[model samples]
Target: MWLPGNTGVYLPQDDTALLIDAMLLAPIPRGARVLDIGTGSGALARAAADCGAAEVTALDVSWRALAAAFVNTRLSGRRVRLRHGDIRKCLPGRHFDVVLANPPYVPCGRGAPGRHSPARAWDAGPDGRAVLDPLCDRAPGLLSPKGMMLMVHSTLCDPEKTLVRLRDGGLKAAVVARARCPFGPVMSSRADWLERAGLIEPGQRDEELVVIRADRTR
Candidate 1:
């Protein structure tokens, strides 16, 4: 799906496609409420809406991303609520039947990307858990009983950690899908730092992306 480009908005890539595949296979009921966190180009939001979700809300910290999403959603003729804010702060006391996230997961020596860099879309802290940890912590609270959360990230960040965190938060979690994709431009450029940091093996040029599914089973 082609979307309008913005200064800092992230374009849909392999990780986004992986999450969309998982979402399509998920057992989300018709007319379910869905939330997409860190919704860059609103691809997931639009996908959920196409899957017959009654309500779809997408949140992102980047204003550029929100604007792009708004345009994309409207162009697709889907009613997705786009909000610009931190996922942890906005929309309190609200829960959804499905929550999806494809957050920043690339290991970066300088931590998060600078304010104006498009790198903000993929550069996570050294351990690559900057956004993953927080998202796991908030998943249970944001999901309704019997709801499910599908999140995608690189294995470099430790998919087990995500499963453990969600399980500790009272959700049954497991890896439902995975894809081995060649390193994108961001990861390709940071290959040296990642190897030096012992996050990736020498000469490794691909990363495995995993989609973790966590269900709030009452």
Candidate 2:
């Protein structure tokens, strides 16, 4: 996919690919209405469109990211509605058959990401639930009955917590896919701090990324 150069837009990475693979394996109904939250470069949105989704809405807080996604999706011959806004606030009252989220799960001491900056693409607060918590709480309300949400995050943030949150929200949730990825620059730089914060092992250099599938069975 074509991405903007140094435009503060997140380029697709291992997490994106993992999510795409899970999405492909999912039994998304044909012509499904799909929502791709935190769509960095529209990779997941394009994948959903290519997988035969009738309508795909891609949301990103970064305008640059949205522009990149728009370009990439259009280049792929997919019609995706690009929205520039936060996932928590955008498209109020909207529901979808499938919700795909590749949120920032990297544990950071920065508290929260700023409105602009590439760091916003992957810096979640300490324990990394800054975005994950809200997403889990909002997912069920955004999903139609029997709809499923596919979310990807790092184990550093506690995958079990995510599962419990989703289950408490009335979804049948489980880890559908997992990949052990070496520490990226951000994680590598913060390894010691993460260990000190008790978020990781003392010498841990790799983090496990898990793709969780939560089905709204109600």
Candidate 3:
């Protein structure tokens, strides 16, 4: 289905989403309980199914997106426990073997129209780690022992800073994948956002997006 300009789809372009799917597949074990946070396109939740996750819980703040995830999961012949709410407050109390998220990594005020826009999904706080901060903070309590948490982030968010945050939160984090592409309109170009956040020197270029794969400290 078409999600229109700036609305994060429950299913986005096949190539990028598929790559995320593959990334998630390798580490998740069969029949493990999994949580897919901000399941924009339900692509990652569905991937969890393919990975043999026994139960998948897909959470998002958008009722509209949850409806789409329900439909998409059915079409794939899989079932997911879907919830609609700000994940920060209403997360299920149970822990999971894995928690995967692709939170908004772009910093706020980078030309987003408002709070509810899909831009919200990509726009972090002033420094581009706002949304991710909470997720990592809560992960220690939410994850099962021996569990893993994988996220797709961007260099715009300062991969090192994110690593620091996750590490401080007790997850051993690392950059597992990265790719540089022509800038998209979703926000300021990575360079501009990075500069605005003081993450890079002026005139320095070569911006990139990244997917970080992190494991909970044993």
Candidate 4:
């Protein structure tokens, strides 16, 4: 949905929104320092506040998206620190106890999200792991020593590869949950790997989704 001035994109669903639903399920510690990367619609940041996080900060490269997040925060009576920058280079000095991201996991293509999705949000290179890899790589540094991170992925991208990348980056990773729903923004090629990895049992399609959790190791 477009805001009044056409300055940003917005969506309202399940009261909390799509991105928020993913973050709300993350097991955040009470009074924890939290970071919501790619805070589209500001759902994650707002939900973090509702969950009693001691501090909440959200970052998105798009000014319009940031503005929308700010508005949503006020409307919901939730306080959050919002910033705009590339997720990797934006805030080098900030660290959080819990990092939540619902990055655009769809692989790069001419038709998807188009060529101008702020690069950081939907441009994940050939296998759609572009954004995911860097996020996983830098997650260790952005997180406090004992902090944990949670991210959402669809069957479209290489879900197992994402888990591997996170683990390889020194984080303890695991698939926390999975559900089936109508496909949104991924290619059909992802179906095979997901079933082969045991993430989706055989014969499950068109209605399954997955959530992954990774914990930073000391």
Q: Global lDDT for candidate 2?
A: 0.90
Q: What does the lDDT read for residue 1 in candidate 1?
A: 49
Each model's lDDT comes to 0.90, 0.90, 0.72, 0.71
Candidate 3 C-alpha lDDT tens digits along 136-203: 77777778888887777667677787788778878877777767654455443565656766776686
Task: Decide which is better by TM-score, 1 or 3.
Answer: 1
Minimum summed lDDT over a 10-residue window in model 3 is located at: 1-10
lDDT for model 1 comes to: 0.90
**Clash count, candidate 1:** 0
The segments of candidate 4 whose C-alpha lies over 4 angstroms from its true place after superposition are 1-26, 111-123, 185-207
For candidate 1, the per-residue lDDT at 30 reads 94
The C-alpha stretches of model 1 lying farther than 4 A from their native spots are 4-7
| Candidate 2 wrongly placed segments (more than 4 Å) | none
Deviation from native of the Cα of residue 3 in model 3, angstroms: 6.4
TM-score of each: 0.96, 0.95, 0.82, 0.78
- Predicted model with the maximum TM-score: 1
- lDDT per residue, candidate 1, 1-218, as tens digits? 45645445788999999999998888668999999999988899999999999999999888888888898889899999888788768788999999999998888888566676788788788899988998899998999999999999999999999999999999999999999999988899989999999999999999999999999997
Candidate 3 lands at a TM-score of 0.82
lDDT (10s digit) by residue, model 4, range 1-218: 22453443534322124445656666577999999888877877888898999999998877778888888888888899998787878788778999888776655544445433544454455466667778888888898988988777665576788888888888899877676665433334555654665545576556434667788778
How many pairs of residues collide in each model? 0, 0, 6, 7
lDDT: worst 10-residue window of model 1: 1-10
At residue 11, give the lDDT of candidate 3: 48
Candidate 3, residue 128: the lDDT equals 72
Name the runs in model 3 displaced over 4 angstroms: 1-25, 110-116, 188-206
